[model samples]
Target: MKTNRLKKSLLGITLSVSLFVSISIMGAPQAAHAATANTTTTAASTSVSGKAGSIIALGKNYLGVRYNFGAQKGVTSSFDCSSFTQYVYGKNGISLPRSSQAQSQVGSYVPRNQLQPGDLVFFYSPIHHVGIYIGNGKIMHTYGSPGVTISDMNSGWWSTHYKTARRVIK
Candidate 1:
């Protein structure tokens, strides 16, 4: 009886520690998100709700950050194309593979017309690039010249180079 009681006590302690760690990790992002937020209505605030608002809201904060090739994951210092998308979505509790090509395989395909906010958009010949669709036929991404910013999805090179779109949020 004593041995069984001790085991139960240990299990209880273990669970408490686990829950504490989880809460700590999760709370950090919520705090940062709330800190940076203004009155913007993200995909999370529209007719749909989930990770979109939180994801886009955070992505907006990175605007004007210069592009860096092969940026290390989790580093907000500078971001590459895939790293930008990965970081934004990752904050919302969604894990994506490191590369744009690999990240493309994680979500379900959606036609361009059906894309809503929080949708992942792919581009280029071999699908080596990606961005988050923020509705209104625009995408927020980092590449070449400008860092994190929005672009017209139907304008110029994007329209001709668009490959596919994926719905990562549901």
Candidate 2:
């Protein structure tokens, strides 16, 4: 009888330990998955910001370039609004459609207040113009007269004509 009780006790102890280990093993992958997802998100955000900075830097290199209504692609001498965005973003591995209307349809929509650098901001009712948000309420784009320039988005024609914005990064 004593031997039987000892065997029962040992069996119970072994079952308990097995259950605990099973639970721990099952939970480990879920915890690791959560941690991995968080790390990936952070890394992706950092990479997007870096790319945005590079695109803006490249755009700035053409700050005063002439504007042509139907500017030729791959030609840097003059740029229409969409051409400017296409050229700059293309240089950094992001491809934008040739027309502002088409570019607006590519990325996810972003609220006006949540605009970030490198976001494509559009103007006009049907989206006639496109610009690169350069932070601080300013956008870099090419237009009549000044050609390529930075304009305030808060209080001017830009503000009134603001239609929508899109985020292409990530």
Candidate 3:
């Protein structure tokens, strides 16, 4: 039984790697920091709803996990802000940079009102934190106590330090 599970896991990983390699070869690699000067942008109406929902669903599954600052990437045990976003999005076949600052430069910017599920919402100046916007102004992110919980974007610290949002699922 264990050997069968191992074979299945290996097969799945091989397929995923093949797809990722093919996609990477077909597209030019762009620096995630290239859009730093632009900072925030306002765009709407192009994101695919299905992808966003899948991303959010994956993120929601991590609720109650502890927040470990500087957690190792790809580890399911615990997650830092960026690593959390990276893993959740990666599970849905999207690649995100490893830091909040670089991630803040991703995708076309969307205004707060225009944010949809799966949009990456950033917080604080210089981009110290990130969360997956799960619609209705709530964000699913890991931080401090009650890790990975969904919180309102319009209230408390998140509201005060609201920086910008990126539509990475587009």
Candidate 4:
């Protein structure tokens, strides 16, 4: 009788331990999967941040370039509004259309207040001009007067002509 009780008790303990082990094994994969997903997300975010930084740096470097109508596509000596935007982003591995109107349609629409460092900002009633946002409500563009210059978004001309902004970097 004692032996029978001992055998039953041992069987119960074995079963409990087996169940605990099975549960742990099942949970381990889920935990690992969650960790892998987090790692991938972090990596993707870092890549995007790096791209944005590159765009801003390019914009800053080309701040003094002159504006030219129908400027050469690959050269930086002169640029139209769209060409200026394209050149800045293109240097960072992002390709934009040759015209401002077309570039406006390429990215997710961003509200004016949420503009980031490398956002493409549009302007004018006919959507004829675009610029690169450089934070602090300032934008860098190749305007007729200043060539490539930084202007406040609230400036007389820009404030009236401001249309929308778009975020191309993902």
Best by TM-score: 1
Cα-based TM-score, every candidate: 0.74, 0.71, 0.71, 0.69
Error of 4 at 56 (Å): 1.5
**Cα-based RMSD of the predictions, in order?**
10.4, 22.1, 10.7, 22.8
What's the alpha carbon RMSD for model 2?
22.1
Pairs that collide in candidate 4 are none
Clashes of each: 1, 0, 0, 0
Query: Which segments of candidate 2 are over 4 A away from where they belong?
Result: 1-49
Q: How well is each residue in 1-170 modelled by candidate 3, as lDDT tens digits?
A: 99999999999999889778745742332222122222121121223245665565556556788999999998766898999999878866899999999999978999988987788999998789999887667788999978778888889988999999999776
Higher-TM-score candidate among 2 and 4?
2
Task: Give lDDT tens digits, candidate 4, residues 94-135.
Answer: 899999999999989999889877789999877989988766
Q: Which clashing pairs does model 3 show? A: none
lDDT of candidate 4? 0.75
Q: Lowest-lDDT window of 10 residues in candidate 4?
A: 39-48
